[model samples]
Target: MANRWLRPEVYPLFAAVGAAIGICGFQLVRNICINPEVRVSKEGRAAGVLENYAEGEKYAEHGLRKYLRNKTPEIMPSINSFFADPNRS
Candidate 1:
């Protein structure tokens, strides 16, 4: 009877089936999204999968700034600022 489908035991079974199916589908999606093999770039191409130009530019700028910051100038600051008495003549 149609009323049998509305029984309490049937609802729990249906709920369990729906939850299992939902979890399975979610896992499949997560695996596809996070799996390195599945998230690969085009065949033999040099470009990255995300194609994030801003990230690349940020790294480039960071490297340039770091290089300039660590490089020493030819002259020392103390020698350049040494006092010379012009009135000694």
Candidate 2:
């Protein structure tokens, strides 16, 4: 009985049928059942953004540290004070 189903000519038809069923199942899940919004969360989105910003800031700080390593340290507190003053147009 099983040998009758395993014949070479019948095998291709069986494979094709299996493939069609798999595709139908996938399409049903994709188009009819699954909700897109449920796959994403606000916390996940915020974490992604925060990680990206942190990576960018880390690279910027590393580059600054490398460049400043050989440069003389100067009094830059006036720069800070100027920005802090805010009243300066």
TM-score leader: 1
Error at 78, model 2, angstroms: 70
In the order shown, what is each candidate's alpha-carbon RMSD?
A: 22.0, 23.9
TM-score of each: 0.39, 0.35
Cα lDDT computed for each candidate against the true fold: 0.65, 0.65
lDDT of 1 at 19: 100
Specify the poorest-scoring 10-residue window by lDDT in model 2. Answer: 30-39
Predicted candidate 2 versus true structure: per-residue lDDT over 1-89, tens digit per residue? 98887889898898899999999998667544333322255675465434355645554566558888976565686786688787887
In model 2, pairs of residues that clash are none
Writing each residue's lDDT as its tens digit, candidate 1 over 1-45 gives 989898887999999999999999986895566544344456624
Question: To one decimal, what is the Cα RMSD in angstroms of model 2 from the true structure?
Answer: 23.9
In candidate 1, residue 86 scores what lDDT? 46
lDDT of 2 at 71: 65
